[model samples]
Target: MKLPLAARVQEAGAALAAEASRFSGYGWMRGTSGNLSIVLDRDPLVLAVTASGLDKSELTDRDVVLIDADGEALDSDDPRPPSAEAGLHAHIAARTGAGAVFHVHAFDAVVAGHRWPGGVEIRDMEMLKGIGHRANDETVTIPVIANDQDMRVEAARFDEVYVAATAEVPEVPALIVANHGMYAWGADVAAARRHLEITEWLLRFAVATR
Candidate 1:
């Protein structure tokens, strides 16, 4: 009893748009600096992603573009051009099987990353449970990668660190790019929202307490 692809995409697009609007309320994405995406189908690989340069607060499903695995727009000949970081979304989906990927340039994330260029470690925080930390005093280290203007190059650099982390910690819900921003993904849109919210929460907490 699965819904048709178009209907599903429409539903996902609406959800993504709503989430984007909510996140845009945050000062970080207030100027259209964040991007969000939700997967529609995996076989042919379709994604409903935010179109580039549009104000997230003003976006609805209309601004979501359906793109393939290769980041080709499937919906419109001029699909408003998907976000510049669409490639990162595609890569995260491929590696994590995540249904949604959310990226934001929060001041807290930048501050935390700058404060700890190697990465940020949040330990003994109750909020860490949001990202699935079990132990009360568990330490969670978010690996940070250097940034590149060419996102494809950035994606490759991310893969190297992401791949290497598999040996020690495999279920990485979010990653930070040095002075860039944070990317969070999860099984679906709701989970992605949870991860994104708490990751930003954790960053803000880290910056505040330090």
Candidate 2:
């Protein structure tokens, strides 16, 4: 359904806030650890993203800041700033055409990303089907990039890795950065949430099995 820009902003603001809170409750975003973003529209380069340092569990729609495509803060009543990972979010949307980007540091993803050595591959799991992969018979390779303190550098590294991973497994929907967190995206918000949920489940399973 088409919505006015203000309504769209509010809708995206609420959805992102709720998603952040849910992830917090799941222990993925504990201690203000994760960030989320949704595209308001492509043309004007508007995005609604979580403000930095806010406790995810109590995040409000007021905490979601609107930023331009280049990551500049747009004029808004909410004076809070976007998260440090704003660059990462913008990079993903630009590179992947993703409508929503969700990042979290669940124990499963952190442990798996660290222990998996080269990269984590999920094979022969029913949950693998959730990320739009064709079959469980094949391995969905999730590249685990080393985390960088400088997000700009990290974003560039992720861009390269994302391109390579997509080239390798075009259907794969997410990637993990070693010792950092996991990123999942999709054509829209609901699809992105499913991808994140399924990937987290698969990562937990892989870690538990090994």
Candidate 3:
């Protein structure tokens, strides 16, 4: 039997908290710097997102808030505001049909975005396979957009740079905001986590080498 929407939301909250804790341990989500989200409904696009201003490492299962496709809070009783970047998460979900999205303030991601404002070009690395790219001669460009205080504007900037996956190339599952951080998505929470980790590792490698 399918779980009720309310139950699904609670389940998503717990799952997001666990993922948040993992990222926090890596120092990628220092203080309350990062956010994670899971899709709860696709028809109208509901999401369970981490609440604003909470320590990522200390999140409980109840720490999440429900938000709509426009990033507006759907649960009026919940006083917590969704993460400031929730709109970007929504846009990515709507655009890519991703089930989960993660954003982290990893040092290497910020550094690489600053160094490569256009986009980061990576090629011929075995780690590339982790992000669904070829491990041999294929080149993948992780899109980077300038940071904006307004997430709506930021989402627009993302749309300007996003490239759809072609038959010959898979879509880049991640993006970087200049001087800010990176956002990664996948079919589900675990896949999103893996993509985020692999993308961060690639950024670290790029920063170290360049």
Q: Each candidate: what lDDT?
A: 0.81, 0.83, 0.92
For model 1 the local lDDT of residue 72 reads 68
Candidate 1: stretches off by over 4 Å: 163-170
Q: 95-114 in candidate 1: lDDT tens per residue?
A: 77889999988788888888
Ranking by lDDT: 3, 2, 1
* Alpha-carbon lDDT of model 1: 0.81
Better of 1 and 3 by TM-score: 3
> For every candidate structure, what is the RMSD over all alpha carbons to the true structure, in angstroms?
2.1, 2.2, 0.8
| Candidate 1: worst-modelled 10 consecutive residues by lDDT | 163-172
Better of 2 and 3 by lDDT: 3
**Model 2: how far residue 10 lies from native, Å:** 1.4
What candidate 2 gets wrong by more than 4 Å, as runs, is: 76-78, 164-168
TM for candidate 3 is 0.98
**Candidate 1 colliding pairs:** none
Residue-pair clashes per candidate: 0, 0, 0
